[model samples]
Target: MVTRREVRLSPSNLNYEDRRCDRCFAEAANGESWPQGPFPGIFAKLDSQQRRYFTDRSTSDIDPTLPPGTLHNGGRVQSAPHAIGGVDFTIRGSMDALLRFDDGSVGVVDFKSSTASPQLGDAYRPQLAAYQWALSRPASDDPEEVSVAGLLVFAPESMVDTEQGRAYLVSTTWIP
Candidate 1:
């Protein structure tokens, strides 16, 4: 009889990495070590700042059309092991933003800064689904009923130079 082992996976693995290659995904699922390509630090910094800036703010801040909700859960969420195809797997990931609607339902939002037109749905479905699964089936913390998930796309609209330095004004759109 094969004894099943537990595996821990980050949500991004389900996104770009898993979608890109099957061998890499298998290696990751089997706990093989792999090197990630260098990502520009500026994007990380901007993401961090954006997370902070939106914390405790209303969902309207992301896009006016969203319901009245407060931003929260800007941290990590890990789920209990879930059996998938006879193997146990746990999803742990840092959420970009979590929203609590006035009615108490929760939502997850991820931020993306792009120069090109953003692609919604398919590209990010697995990643967002991982978070929703993790939140609804937590390992230690109480489970959250995730009512919605979406992407907040920030695309550059204009650039200007001021005494402080150069700045780019971005446009935000919520794709649910």
Candidate 2:
């Protein structure tokens, strides 16, 4: 009997060469090693706050281009395991948010933190595209129609001393 190995793919993985590294794929398939990163507590807190704000208000003060929609918080999205080059792979990701538009379309939004204004360069495009692809899949809930995808980047613009303590001036940038 022929056996097909399973591998998991994520948006972050897609950011790196579309997760085509044979060695990494093999390791992940064997359940030996997977991607790891330093914990981002501050970013997580900020992301949670923003998500809650949008969810509570049913709107976003940051991105005006976003249509009237209901914000769905972070969740796991996955594609059925499939074979690529004889290796079975399941593309999956924890999307930051999915906006279900009134017109039966969905919008993908990713939150990013940086010291300077975020740029929509080559490094980040694949990650956003992966989210767009995941949301557009027929298996996804709702209409599964991806109308738009974007990044909501938060950056520190300045620092100032206040009566309480030092405060940083933050700026938000939306890149579609």
> Compared with the true structure, what per-residue lDDT tens digits does model 2 show for residues 1-176?
98876766677666645456778755664677665687678877888877776663443565666787677785878765556887876668898877778888877778777533334445578887777666665244643778878776778889999999997788878777
Q: Which numbered prediction scores highest in TM-score against the true structure?
A: 1
Q: How does each model score on lDDT?
A: 0.83, 0.70
TM-score of each: 0.90, 0.75
Q: Residue 75's C-alpha lDDT in candidate 1?
A: 85
Candidate 1: worst 10 consecutive residues by lDDT?
Answer: 114-123
Show model 1 residue runs off by greater than 4 Å: 16-18, 115-118
Q: Please list all clashing residue pairs in model 2, or write none if there are none.
A: none
Estimate candidate 2's alpha-carbon lDDT, on a 0 to 1 scale. 0.70
Model 2 weakest lDDT span, ten residues long: 114-123
